[model samples]
Target: MMKPVTAQDLQTAGFVPERRRGPAVSVAQATVDAIQTMIRTGHLRPGESLPPQRNLARDLSVSRATLREALSILATIGEITAKPSGRGFVCADPGEKPATPSWRFAARYSLREVYQFRHVVESYAAQLAAIGHTDPELAELRECLQTFRRAALAGDISLYAQADFDFHHLIMRICRNKLLVDMHQTFASILLESQRLPTERRGNLMHAVQEHESILEAIAIRDPEGASYYMRKHISMAGSRAGLPLSELP
Candidate 1:
């Protein structure tokens, strides 16, 4: 038997078995949420221009890749019509309105639920990502980590957040599955709202940074099972710390 690796296995490997996903918000979540808020509030009409990707990413506290993934997802879910090299994503016709109870339920829902959902979906995506990830994909993942480490050391919250979001965004790209990525993008806002600050709850940022390094090493080895295990542990640990239930994440 491949030795049954417990969370403790992470330690001897020089990594804590923290939840891999950490119910963190993806870049798509942040982007979609802003767009949805604008649409319902009449701030963004059917044909309004979205700010440029770089500017929007800065404003939304996400990365360009995350925003792009969100756009792709929104387009897939019929939220916005895309324009090539256009300034922003456009609003589509509002879909069928749900019942009042449904709306209320959604409105009251926390973004943590969204992150939880991603934990499930992206956990699976991580498995796929490990299988399909290429050299370029690995490089991108490394670059994101480097940016994240640099930002963390410098105590730059915005850049840290951006880089943090990008690391997972690149992992999703490794899945060779657009549908899963799009689904995540479609509800970007909920995720943004849910995973506001995983790192905030951490007692030590440098400790967390060290854990992230282990995750990247597993992915570089293309160890799908290992990557999936680490990701699940990371997400689950964060949820536990946040006092969240996986089933209750919505």
Candidate 2:
């Protein structure tokens, strides 16, 4: 019978050592190494949800942003999976073989291209959301905006990014366009990368809060043109803040 892995097990696996901090990105990479050590040593298993971010960050003596970045890297490589509802990430079976790569690589675009595409689809979706969303959908949008604002003000980079993603995702969902939503889903990683950039700059985060408020208000008033306008402006501002070149607005 296997013993259930505890925090002591993680410590034994070298995940609890205090390390000298370097650059932010490097710290994230080190965190990933610590987590990989935990998995290799059976301190974490497939399908096991890791500890809450707060606990893990405290234990590792790293900021939550660094921890989240490490997890994002793991998720990208399929060593873990993010829960669809923002619950948390779960560990993947390390022994499971990865699938063969598809030819979709031939059609892959840069992050900038993906951002351009998002600006087009999401702006149009915002317009549709304004014209078609019900009262409940509008309420959900407001809730997402408030969640984002709170996260931003609290300096919770990971939660703020999640809320920002949820707000745009809600817009696409209520847009009533399956094709648009599918497109957004396909470029989800690029969108996440873009959104993460703004969190590094407080000005960008606060600006996003006001921009989302305006966008939601436009939708609330059932003004499709206003919705489209604000959405476009919001995306443009976000791109600029992230140091991405502004693309032609839709």
Best by lDDT: 2
- How many residue pairs clash in all the candidates, one count each? 17, 0
How close to the true structure is residue 173 of candidate 2, measured as C-alpha lDDT? 95
lDDT of 1 at 233: 56
On a 0 to 100 scale, what is the lDDT of residue 188 in model 2? 76
Cα displacement (angstroms), candidate 1, residue 108, comes to 5.1
Which portions of model 1 miss their true places by more than 4 Å? Answer: 1-108, 240-250
Q: Write the per-residue lDDT of candidate 1 for residues 1-250, one digit (tens) a residue.
A: 1123233332333321122324564435545555565556565566665666776555555567876766654554445765656446656656532211112225656546555676777677778777777898888888888888898798876676567566666777778788877866676655543333544432233434565676677777878787877776556544433334333433
Runs in model 2 deviating more than 4 A are 1-108, 202-204, 246-250
TM-scores across all candidates? Answer: 0.51, 0.55
Highest-TM-score candidate:
2
